[model samples]
Each structure stands twice: as structure tokens, then as C-alpha cells.
Target: MRVRNKPWADDLITENPQAIVLNPEHYRGQWQSRFKSVQPLHVEIGTGKGQFLIGMAVAHPEFNFVGIELQKSVLAAALKQSLPAELPNLQWVLADGQGVNDFFEPREVTQLYLNFSDPWPKTRHEKRRLTYKSFLKSYAEVLGDGGQLQFKTDNRHLFEYSIMSMTSFGLNLTELSLDLHADVAASQGELENIETEYEQKFAAKGQPIYRLVAQFPKK
Candidate 1:
């Protein structure tokens, strides 16, 4: 997913400090202070164009949402889409996902979302996967015991790998769906799903969307 470079990307970030949080490290344990009211924090790592998170913020006002994107232009694009909404509970972060723990205190996050993250399919790049042991460890620390981790992907290999990685990390698999859209269409169960930008495109091609909801094991 190579996004076209936007010349105004830097200006968007610099101009909107309130929406795009530049110094997330300083907020760390006190993330609630950034929002209008103290509430549970839900963060989406690898948030691309911000479609899913924006919908989530609108649908669930009880929770605060933070979207973290590594690319500046992409983050700016997300900002452009999200700014008009003026969601009080939503914010954005421009940083690497690997430093998630550094930006949040232990057990600070209430939930975490990983949607269509890069698979890094090569064997040598396993460590770079979001479900890799080290990343899971950091997620566990931030989410604490019994906190939820919701993941979605169109890649079967990555989905299978994530199941193994998450379970091996002692996270309990609460739910699993091989074809989410099909299930939702058939009304197989009560699943209110929010679609990401990538999801809409991939699903349009008739590809199955894999989704899993897991929770950290209680200490």
C-alpha cells in the first residue's frame, strides 16, 4: 500500500496539534487527560486512512480512540478525513507501532486493534509481525489482564500465524471468524463490525476477511 506523497502533509500535522499528537511520549500514563472526559482508551495501530477508527469513535462515544500511523502522508490523510468530524474522543499519533509501550503506561490501554497490518511474510521478518512475541508482550503490558485485542486481515497466512502467536503468548481466543462479511450478511451472529479502508477494497474483490478477538490472560 504505497500512498501518493502529499506536499501539505507536514503542514497538516504542524497546524493541528490538538488532533495529531506529536509528543505522545509525554502523555504516557495520562492519556485520559487529553480527551474531554476520562474514559477507556482504545488504540488502533497501523491505522491507515482512519476509516475504521473514525467510525468506531462515532459509534462508541464512551471510549477514547487513538490511531497510530507510521507514515506522515498517510497520517496526514487520516487527519484530513477525521478533522471535519470533530470527534472529541478521537486523536492521532505519528509514530512507529514498535514503540507502543513507550507511549502508554502498563495497563493503560483498554483495548487494541490491529487491522490489515503488513504481514512481513518472510520467515526472517517474523519478529516484525504485530503478533510476534515481543509485540504481543508490549501489547499485554499496555492492555493488562483480560484486555481485548481485536485483529482483522485479508491474508490467510498472517491470520493463521496470528492465531498461533497470540495463543502462544497466553492470550485467550474469544472469537474467530473466517469470513466476516459472509457471517454478517447471513446474520449468523451478533457482530457489529467496522470496516477499514483496506477492508472495503479487499472485500469488494470477494476475499474473505479473517477476524479474531483475543484477551490477555489474567495474572
Candidate 2:
């Protein structure tokens, strides 16, 4: 999808000094020290409109967050929102999601968030889907052993496909829920605040948002 260029893009670029990693290669194998102290780093791939990534960073001050999006226009919007908040724990990267392993060393990421990622429903486009086996392998390389992947999507087909992919990749899947809100109400401490624009829309429509948490086995 082509992203519409926004006039504010230039301003966003200037405002987000810390968000832009001019030399990501320098931090390789030394990302832990970027935080005040060593803390778990969570990454959200394809963070559209920046709502969820920003909200999570605000909510979880103890954990560092890196949000990656390939579209410059979408990333600009996120950068604008993030700059005003001056969130110390959050950073944004404009890069292909598939290249995550190249940017971080092995076992560097503690958790990953994949919220309402592209369904890529066509069989021919399965490889482009973020939950495809190839992408899972990339995530595994950066994620620590036993690190968790939290995924939520409104598309049932994509959710099912993701579950299959996770299992095929030898991940231990748990906390599967077809309806997140209903499941959350039934189980205390199960609900987290809605962070993404799609999530809010889905909730307004009373849609059943499927969610799952998968953990990589210790190697």
C-alpha cells in the first residue's frame, strides 16, 4: 500500500532526535546499556499509526520498546506523536520488518508484539505475512530463549494460520483466546488497555479479537 506523504514529515524528522537511530550498527551486541539499567526490550513490528507502540511505552516504563514500520508517512505520524510525549523508553525505526534480526543481535529482544498485522490472505502472498515461518525464524533469532510473542488480530483466518505457523516453528503456544474482551472479563488481569487504532475500531464493532501468546523454547 502506498502511504500518502504528509507535510509534517520534515518536522517529525527534526523533532524525534532520539527516536532516529543514525548508527544502529554501533549498538549491536550493546543494546542493553541503552536503557538506564538493563531492562527487557519489546518490539512491535509494523506499528501502524503509532498508537499501540506509544501506549505500551507509556504504560510500561520498565521495559524498552522499539517500533518498526516501513512506510515513511506512517512512521512520520508515529514519530510526531512520540516526540511530544518525550518517552525515554521508546524508539522508532523505519525498516522492513523482515530485517529485524540484522538490526539486533541474537537474544536481544525480550518480547514481540504483532497487533493486527497484514493478513495477506492470498495463498500466493503467504510469504509476505508477518507470521509466516520465515518471519518467525527471524523473530526467534533476536528474541531471547523463552521470550514471548503477543499477537492479536480480528481476522480469524489469519489468527488460525498464525497459530499453525507458531506451532510449526516449535513455539509453545498458550493463552489462546478467540474473544479477547470476553476472555479478559472472565479472567482477572488478563485485559490490557487498547493501544492500536484497529483495536479500537474492532472493539467498537463488538468484534471478537483473537489473541495468543507464544513462547520460544529454551535452546
lDDT of each: 0.94, 0.85
Model 1 is weakest, by summed lDDT over 10 consecutive residues, at 182-191
Could you say which candidate leads in lDDT? 1
Measured against the true structure, the TM-scores of the candidates, in listed sequence, are 0.97, 0.92
Over the stretch 76-127, how does candidate 2's per-residue lDDT look in tens digits? 8888878878788887777777788888999989999999998999999999
C-alpha RMSD for every candidate? 1.1, 1.7
Give lDDT for model 1: 0.94
| Residue 136 Cα positional deviation in candidate 2, in Å, after optimal superposition | 0.9
**Displacement of the residue 118 alpha carbon in candidate 2, Å:** 0.8
